[model samples]
Target chain A: MNVFVLFKKEAKEQVKTYRLLIVAAVFLLFGLSTPLLFKFLPEILEMSGEGIPIEIPAFTPSDALKSYVNSLGQIGVLVAVLVAMGAIAQERERGTIIMTLSKPVGFGEFAVAKLAALVVTFLIGVALGALACFYYTTVLLGSVDVQAFLAINLLIALYFVVCLSITLMYSAFFKSQLAAGALALVTLLVMGIVSSIPPLAPYMPSALMGWGQSLAVEGGGSAWPALIISGAIIVAAVLAAWQVLSRKEL
Target chain B: MTEAIVCKGLSKRYGRLLALDNLDLHVEEKTIFGFLGPNGAGKTSALRILAGLSRATSGKAWVAGEEARLNSSVLQRRLGYLPEDPAFYNWMSANEYLTFVGELFKLPSAELAARRAELLALVDLAGAASRRIGGYSRGMKQRLGIAQALMNRPAVLLLDEPCSALDPIGRLEVLETLVKLKEQKTTVFMSSHILADVERVCDVVAVIDKGKLIVQAGVEELRQRFAHPVFELEFDQPADSAIPLLQKVPGVTRVVTENRAGGVPVLRVHVTDTAKARHGLLHAVETSNLALRRYEIVLPSLEEVFVELVANHKEQSR
Candidate 1:
């Protein structure tokens, strides 16, 4: 009950701060632009041409879908990090956590409640963004495969969950909001760079985003191992955050 | 009387700094217990340990017969704490924040609303209940902090410097609120360096210095134990001659003269026995050329007792 109450407060905070609106607007813009950019690229280039004939690759609906997934995997992850980087760090810095945790709520419950709130908001924002992309992909280009589109979006959502959890983990561990954000972005970038290597490709979380892009572009790859690894890491991050925060002097 | 809160050798060390050093404290139920100390005197460290926000390095504490620790949900439910600098979500109004806190305590909806209204009125914040906390003054925030702490009606309320950041009016308002809580038999353990504020509201006070307990006694007992008996005499004429005459009388320990607002000299007689000094002073004034305007016996205030106790403790430690 305490966890649910805390979750509600955090969700309300997100709404009050207009984080939900900012994320939704950013993702919706990505959704609208991804398809429109590809459809008009040849003509846009023609307008800037120097009279030399340029051969443009025949663009397909899959290209637009692939672009949408790529944008979410890259820019969408950044947006998630931006929204979640201050979830705990700001409260701790401001000494607000001292009052709230002085009640009957456990640190584990507090950490989990915050995580759940951000995840729920992230999921909703991503779903709405995915809907916008799907609508544009079908109307501007040819018809998209519904199953393949859902699968790619789901995989991308999992990738986003990993990003959000890492942001939360660093936010709990660090006292400075800017330091938490910098460290979370650095850690995610290192993970992405290291996971793309041939040896670690199958077991790394960063591969999930690539696999999501592949699925969207009709280049198939197994997402199960990355899914399992990312899921375990998410659990580990939440648990570690709870442990560190519970032992904190505040 | 029952012990609402107890700490046994409660010690907290932050790396090399000893925040609390083997401190033991007992707060009886239904009493306003004042934890008094200067800054860095470990008053806050002890209260935080009892509130279960921070752990003691080597000791244990209990609140309401249960061990005090963050993991004990049952124990936390019976304890309410207002931090030295109480902070809240600025985005929330006073009403919304208290409601959120009540929900965390899992209060029934109807009961929560009733208690919220009662506490808002108690803190004199009902009129501003709908305003965001960001717009509140420091005193307003302190009052709302108290209201939130009382929402659960816990067995005990731990306040750290509850009136430290308030103006005189704000301080008086908060003290009055705590005085009202005494009727409900709420055990309040509040810490402050403001001796006058403690003297006004707390029945019992424990003075701590250098992370150790110096003295623990009732306000009256503290005055009787550590304070000296004093008498003040205002003379229409210069009392320089009367000092020698007064000091000659037995039981009159020391005499000092000062000039009042109108340049009139007043004699302050430190006495060992008030009854003996009363007659001796009156007779001396009549016999001498000094014309006495008024003679009054002054009991020691808590401020004097606190200073004497802290100074004695410092000297003993040295």
Candidate 2:
């Protein structure tokens, strides 16, 4: 229970610093800027018409909105990973974990605190970006069902949480924060690649990406299995991380 | 005094290398106990076990009358430990660091603040409490380490080489603070290879070498038990005559001269016991009537005994 205090303290210390701000800024820029920038890309491509009778899809507000959402999906995952990259490794390297361990706090309490803090940070960044995307889409693409929009936002936020959980797993495994940060990013990419190969995409967390993408076409049902599995995956990853960390020597 | 700290056959192995070998230790309550060993002698490993930071490979230890292996996280709230080279969160100020440690112990807000202020002041860090620990000197860091250790008024405090990183002045201050801790009835188990620092504040000294405890006794008893009695004497005769007769004394082991002034005889005597040697020296002096100018008992310093014990162990190990 007191681990909440420790978690809150970590979260507070983290937010007061520039990490949270920078992450939000990067995602915010991606959320707000990518769609608008890509609106001109189709035009630019159509003018380039120097080859093979090239045709370009007409730029639409949905194209702009998907660009924004996809940017959030990709870079936001990176931001989440980087934000939590060293939660455990930082404490290990600084010997701060010794201080925490020397107290009544258990490894579960410590790891959970870090995991939850990252989840909350990811939620904050993605939620804000989703809000920006939602407003911009309303103005450009005309009103979609509010429910579909919120569902997509919810799915994006869930994807961000998946990244946070993976980052926590990496953070728990490495001695260097950089190792955790790098591994989390790589793991995300690997998950994406694994899902892209036929057949396996149905079960992978990265399938959530494809699921999020198809939300406009097939609605939320396309992602129900992915969402359910992502939930299962997050819990399994956290448990696996806990097992690895519980046995790890300080 | 009750035993505040006890370890029974505490064995730890780092794979093939045995860090601690069947180590048994008992430290009396309210006494400053020095846990001494050279580098890689498993001093840190032992202290870490006691602090509950690391688990033992084989055996168990107890701190403040409770078992100390695996459950040390529970013990963490009750005891304080400083690693050999304790690294702070370089990002936090000294006050911030101590407060963070205090919070980990679950000290309530007001109590935590007052305790942090008091401990910071005790280590002479009140003036620089706001300075980032990374910016502090080694001495300042060591002092802050002590303040943090004393934060909870832990019944059993374990310090791992508290003075090892400090300047001479910083060393003196930390040793003095440790002395104060002893007076406050906090049983302290401070580990170090520096005999002088141990001798300064610890009355009970436990010496571990090569992962085995060579001796664990009071500083006074250590000097009395590990070494033979020694005496320096000056007589008004040729030094050569005293050497033969001095060895002839029942308890005396060797006779070597330390000073001979203007042809006067001066000799240093190694005896098994000072009381018996005094009797023999008086008897030798009375029989020979050699005018005695200087006759004094010289006991071995802890440093000499430590070196001798470790060197002997090294020789025997090979």
Candidate 3:
């Protein structure tokens, strides 16, 4: 119940701070542009007048959606880290954590409430982006497989959840937002590198992005290990943040 | 009286520096207790431990009959704490912040609303409750800090330098509010270095220096225990000649002449024995043929006792 109250406050803070607006705008821009860019690349390149005529294949919905997944995988991760890196560090720096935690708020509840609010904000952003992408792909290109599109977006959202939780954990560890953000980005970059190795691809969080791209381009293989591991990482990161905050001398 | 707050051998250390060294304190219910110390004297450290925001390296504390541990919801619910420099969400209005705090305590909706209004009015912030907190002055923020701490009517209220950011009028208002909390049987344990404010409202005070307890007693009792008796004498003429005679008197520890503007010189006689020094001082004045204008024994202020206690502690530690 206390978590509910804190969640409401955290959500309101996201809205009032314009973080929600910034996130939605970023996602919406990528969503609208990914399909439009895929459809008009030939014309755009011809206009550039490179002196040599290059052979361009016909644009497909799979190409547009796959590009969307890849764009979100790179730029979306940056947005997640930026949004969450200050969630705890800024509160501690400003002395607001002392005020909020001085009440009857459990450290776990405080951490979980923040994570839950961020999750909702990202979910909304992902939904809007997916809707725009779907609408554009159907209008400007061919129709997309609705189920595959939904699965791909869900995977993308889960990938972002992993990024946010890890960033929040670093935010709890350090008082400087810059340090937290840099460290979170480094950790995610390491994971992205590890996911490219064939032996470790199934176990890494970045595999979720690969899994989403595969769902969009191909048909049906499941990265069950990656899905389960991503879920575990999210839970573990939130719990680590809670433990760090509980022991901290706010 | 029941002890609303108690600490047994509480100590804290950061690396080689000892912030709090085996400090013990007992604060009774329904009293305004002052925790006085110089900067870095471990006053904030002890308060943080009692407030359950930080853990002590050793020893234990209890507030309102519950053990005070870091992040204990049960303990947190029973008490309220106001940090030295309270921060708020800049975008939030006073009304919004108070409502958010009240909800954190799980207060009923109707009660939360009424309590928010009452607290805003109590802090004289009702007129600007709707304004963003980012625009508030430091004094206004301090008052809001006080108001939020009292939202739950806590059994024990711990404040760290509650009035440090306030002006004279704001300080008086907060002091008066503390007095009212005592009347309502809420124990307020406030830490501050402002001796005059502590002297005015605190029923009991504990003075600490160098992370160790110097003295703990009632305000008047502290003055009585640690302060030396002093006599202020005004003479019709220069008392420079009388100083040597007064120094010769038994029980007179020190004597100094105070020069007043457009008036005759005065002598302050500090003594260990008031009775013997009183008689001897008068005899010494008469023998020197100095005509006395006024003679009065002055009670020492808390500032004097505090300075003496800290100075003596420093001397003894050396």
For each candidate in turn, the TM-score is: 0.91, 0.85, 0.93
Give one digit per residue, the lDDT tens place, for model 2 in A67-93: 666777767777788777788887787
Candidates' lDDT values, in order? 0.87, 0.78, 0.92
Lowest summed lDDT window (length 10), candidate 2 chain A? A214-223
Best by lDDT: 3
Worst 10 residues of 3 chain B by lDDT: B256-265
lDDT of 2 by residue, B216-239 (tens): 888888887787767888866665
| Model 3 superposed RMSD (Cα) | 2.9
Best first by DockQ, ranked: 3, 1, 2
Candidate 1 local lDDT, A1-250, one digit each (tens): 4888999999998888898888878878888888888888998888789777889996898898878887787898888888889999999999899889888888988889988888878878778888888888788787888888888878887888899889999999878888989989999999988886888888888788778778777658776888999999899989988988878776
lDDT of 1 by residue, B1-318 (tens): 999999899889999999888998888999999998878999888888888888889988999899987567888899889999999999999999999999989999999999999999999999999999999999999999899899889899999999988999989989988888887899999998788999999999999998999999999999998888888899787778888888887798778776779999778888877787788878887778776788888886788778778888999999
Candidate 3 C-alpha error for residue B282, in Å: 7.2
Give the lowest summed-lDDT range of ten residues in model 2 chain B.
B69-78
Q: Where is model 2 more than 4 Å wrong at Cα?
A: A40-58, A140-145, A217-221, B71-73, B228-297
Tens digits of per-residue lDDT for model 3, B1-318: 899999999999988989999999999999999999989999999988888899999999999999989988899899989999999999999999999999998899999999999999889999999999999999999999998899999999999999999899999999999999999999999998788999999999999997899889999999889999889999887889889999999999888777889777778888989998888988998899988999999997898789889989999999
